[model samples]
Target: MTSSLSWRLAFCFTLWLSQPLSLQAQETLADWRDVPVAQLEQGAQNGVADAQYALGLRLEKGRGLLQNFALAATWFTRAADQGHAAAQHRLGQYYFDGIGVETNAQAALNWLRKAAQAGDATYLYDLARVLETQPEGKPLAADLYQQAADLGHQEAAVSLAVLYQNGTGVAQDFARALQLYEGPAAAGQARAQNNLGLLYVRGNGVQQDYVRAAALFQAAADQGLALAMGNLATMYENGFGVPLDEALAVELHQLAARKNSAKTGNLHPGWVFDTRLAPPDSSAEALERLRQGVTRGDPLAGFLLGWHHLQKTETSQEEFRQAARLLRSSAEAGYPPAMANLGLMYFEGRALPQDYVLGYMWLVLAASAGQPEAPELAVVLSARMTQSQLVEAQELAVIKGGDQLANR
Candidate 1:
C-alpha cells in the first residue's frame, strides 16, 4: 500500500479502536455495506460512466471487496473514454502515482488536460501541478491555475498567487499575489493563509500589519502548515502581534522543524522534466543521473554535483579538490551558484590559496547572473579589497580571460 493509504488506514483503525468495543466490527463492516459490488459491476458493464467511476473507486479502495488497482484502472479508463471528467482525473492521477498504471507523466498530462477541458476545477488544479514541473510549462500552468481560481478553487488560487509572488512565468506582482491569496486565505487554504501573512510582515502589496500577519499565521499553523508555525513563533518571540514568549516560540519552531519538507514555490532547472521520467529514488541512481546530465554538458548538474560533494560531512581532501574542480567547470559554463560557491571557497583558502581578487571577481560575475547569495558575499568580500584590487577584480570579472585563470 502507498504511505497515504497506510496513514489513512491507521487513522481509521485508531478511530475504530477508540469507539465502544462492541460496535467496532459492526461500524467497520457498515462503512463498506453501502457500496454494493455486484450492482456496481453490472452498471459498469452497461457502460454507465458514473457507475463505472464509482465501481472503480470501490475496487481501488477495497470497499466490500479485495483491492484491485488493475481492474480499477480499467474501469476508470472506460468511464474516462465516456467523457467522465472525474474518472479522467482519477485515471491520470493513478498513472502519475504508478498505482495501477506505469508512471507516465505524459499520459498523466494528456488525461489531466482532457479533464481540465471538461470544466472541472479540481482536475484543472491537478494538471497545473504536473505542468509546473515542466520546462516552459509554467506559463500554461499559470493560465490553468487562473481558470481554476476563477471557478473558486481555493488551492488553485493559492498556487496562482505563488507564481505571481515569485515571478515564475509571470510578472512579479505582489499586489496581485496578495489579491489572489485573500480569497483562498479566507476560504481556509493553509498555504495561501501563510503566504498572505508573509506579505503582511514584509509590507508587500499591503500595509504592514503585524497583528493581521500573526492572525493569518495562526490560522495556517492550526491547519498544520509548518512554515506558518515558524512565522507565528517569530511573532511570539518578537512581540510583534503576540506576547513575547520565548518558550512558546521554541515549541512552535520545533513543530515546524518536524514537518521535514514542504511545497515552496521556487522552481529550479532540475524540475524541468519534459521527458516524462520519475525522479531517481536512491543516492547512486541520483548520482548516475547527474553524471548523465553532466555528460550532456548540463552546467546545472555539474553545479549540483559540486555542491553535493562539498556538503558531505566526512569529505576527504581529494573530494574537496574534486568539488572545487567540478565547481570550476560549472562556473566556466556560467552556472551562478557554482561561481558563488567557488568564489567563497577561494576566498576562504579551501583547496587553494586565498585569492581575494579572483574571489571578488567570481562573486561579482555570480551577482550579475542573479545568484541569490552572491551579492551579500560580494559586499562583504569587496570591503576587504584595496581600491586597486577592486579595480583589478572588476576588470578581470568582465573580461573573457578564458584560459588564463585555468592555466594558472
Candidate 2:
C-alpha cells in the first residue's frame, strides 16, 4: 500500500499523467497536407471530420494559422461528434488540461472512453490513468492497465506492477510485480527501474541486494528522476550499497531538489545538507559543518556555503568574492546549480566580469545537466547577446561536454 500510494503521488504531475499531444499525427491526418486554408476551412464547414481534425491541429499548433485553443477545441468537438478517434482523444486532452474549455474530469473521462472503444492501447492507458484517480474506478483501472500492458504499453506495465506490488484492487504478488518491471526497466523506463529498485531494497521476492538496488537507482537518477536521485543519495550517505561520500550525497540531494522544484517552475528551491538521521541543532552548527566539508574539498559543500552567504541580507564585498570563488569551484566540478548560479553572477557582473558568452555557456551546461530553468533563462539572456556571442557560447557548451538528455 505504501509503495502504491508513493507511486501515484510521485507521478501526480509526471509519469505522463497529462500526456502531451503528439506533434506528428497519423498519415490519415496528413490528407490536407498542402491544402490551402480556405479549402480546408470549406471542407471543415462541409462537415468533413478529417478536415476538421486537420484544421484543429493547425489551429492548435499555429502551423499555418493563428494559435487558438478555443477554436481548436471547437473543431475537435465537431470531428469528435462524427466519431473520429483522434479527435476524441484530443478533445479529452483539452478537457483534461483545461486548454480551451473549463477543466472537467468527467467529460475528459467520457471522451477518453469513447476514444478507447476501438481497443487502442494508448487510448486505454490514457483512460486508465484518469480512472485511477477515482476511488470507485480502481478495479476497472487495473483491468484497463493490464489490457494496455499486454498490448505493449510500457507505462501501463509499470502502473500495473504497482498494483500487484501493493495489492491495490489485485492480489499482492511481488513475483508478478518483478515480472512486469523487468522488461520496462531493461528498456530504460526510469519509473520501472526506480520501483524495481524499491522492491530489491525491501527484498520483496528476491534476496536483498543493495548493490543491485543502488545500480537501479543510479540508472533512474541519471535520467533525472527526483525520487531515484533521493534514493541514491540515501545509499551514498549511509554507505548502504556504495562507499560513503558525504559530498556526493549532498550534491545528489540538491540535484533531486532542483529537479523536483524545476517541474513546478521554482527558480531557487531550498535544500538541506543533513544526511544524518539526526541533524545539528542550529543554523550556525550547520554552517560549521558545511565549512568543515568545504575544507575537505567537498564541492557541493562549497557551493552550499557560497549560496548561504549570498542569501544574507547584508553581505560584504569580501563575502561576494568568497561566494564567487566557491561557486566557480563547484561549477567547474560540474554541479548544475553551481553552474547556473555562477552563470547568473557572471551575467549580472556580481563579483565577476560581465561576459555574456561565458554566462550563456554555463547556462547551457546546466540545462544539459537537467536544470530546467537554465535553457529558458539562457534564451532570455541571449536576447542581450550578439549572434556571434550566441554561436560562441553554444560551441563552448558542446566543447565542455554537455550531456545529451534522453526525451522523456
Candidate 3:
C-alpha cells in the first residue's frame, strides 16, 4: 500500500511484484544491457548464478536479449541447479504457468518449496500462492501463508485469514480468524478491515459490538472496499451504530454495487498483567494458542505469550530470547502494555542491556496511549534524563505513534 504496485493473485509463482526504485539498483540491470552476449553466455555456463539469472531476466523480458522462454528457462535451471533462490523461484513460476517448461506440477512444487524455504518473504508468498492451486494443497498453502505472514507478508496474512474464515484448510475457528484479522485491519488493511467487520456483525469471535463493527466498516469503506461500503450501509440503515439514515445507507450500497467486481526476549519492567487477555487454561494450551496467534501476527497474543514464558521457571535461555523477540514484536505492533513492559525492561536491564532513552520513549508512548502506569513512570524516569535525551525520545515517540495510529 505504500507503493504504486499491488499484488494480484495468479497461477505463476510471481504475483506482479514491481521492484522498488533505488539509485544504486538503477545502475545494475538497467545499465548492463550493453554487456556482450558472449560474455553473458560464458558466465552463465561457467555457473555464475547472478549472470544466469540476469541474462534469463533479460531474455524473458527481451531487454538485452531476444524474448525466448525456452532459453530463459534453460538459463534459470542452470542457476537454480546451483541453488540460486531467485532462479529457482522463477523456474518454478515458469513450470506452473507453462511459459517455457511443460506444465509439471510436481516440478513446480519442488522448485517453489526450495525457493520458499531458502529465499526471503517474497519467495515464501509465491510458494504459498502456487500451493493454493493444488486440489489437496490448501492446508499446505495455508501453513506456508502463515509462515510468510509471520515474516510480515501482509498479503499472505489476508489469504491465510480467508482460509480460516472459510474452513477450507484450517479449522473454522472464528476466534482464530479474528485474531489474524485484527492486526492488519487496525493497520488500515482494507480487505482485512472489511472482513473483520463481517465477523463482528455475526458475533463469531469477540463480543458483538456494532459500534466497533461500523467503525471498522467505515474505515474500509473509506478506502474503496466495495463489500465494506455495503456493510456500512446496512449498519446505517439499521441504526446499528450511527443514527439510522436510509438515504445515506442507500448511497453507500449504491456506491458499493458500482465497485462490487473489484476486490524481545527479556524480563523487565512496567507490569505483570493488564487483564485484557484471559489467562490460559493451562500453560501448554497457552503456549500453543499464543504461538498460533503469533504466527498470525497478533501482537496481543505475542505479548501475552512472552509474558507467559517470562513467568515460567522451566523456560530456557533460548526460550527467554524467544519471549523477548515476541514482546518486541508486539511492542512494534503498538500494543501499549508491550510498549510499557519493554520500556521498563530496557530501563531496568531485564535480560537485556540498558537503553534509558529507548525505555523513556516507550514509556512515553504507553502513557500517550492511555496505559495507566505509563504517565507516572515516564515522569519518574524523565527526571534522570538529560534535556537532549528527553527531546530525542519525545521526537522518536511522536514519529512511532504517528505511524502506528495511521494503521490503527
User: All models: lDDT?
Assistant: 0.71, 0.77, 0.72
- Predicted structure 2: clash tally: 0
User: TM-score for each prediction?
Assistant: 0.54, 0.62, 0.50
Off by over 4 Å in 1: 1-35, 257-408
Sort the predicted structures by TM-score, highest score first.
2, 1, 3
Residue-wise lDDT of candidate 1 within 178-284, one digit each (tens)?
99999888988888888888888888899999899899999999998777888788888778877778789899988887652222211111211112334333398
Candidates 2 and 3: which is better by TM-score?
Answer: 2
> What tens-digit string does per-residue lDDT give for candidate 3 at 205-306?
788888988999899889987667877888878888788888998999788766642221122233546667676545576679878999999998888888
Q: Judged by lDDT against the true structure, how good is candidate 3?
A: 0.72
Q: Best lDDT goes to which candidate? A: 2
Give the C-alpha miss distance for residue 23 in model 1, angstroms. 32
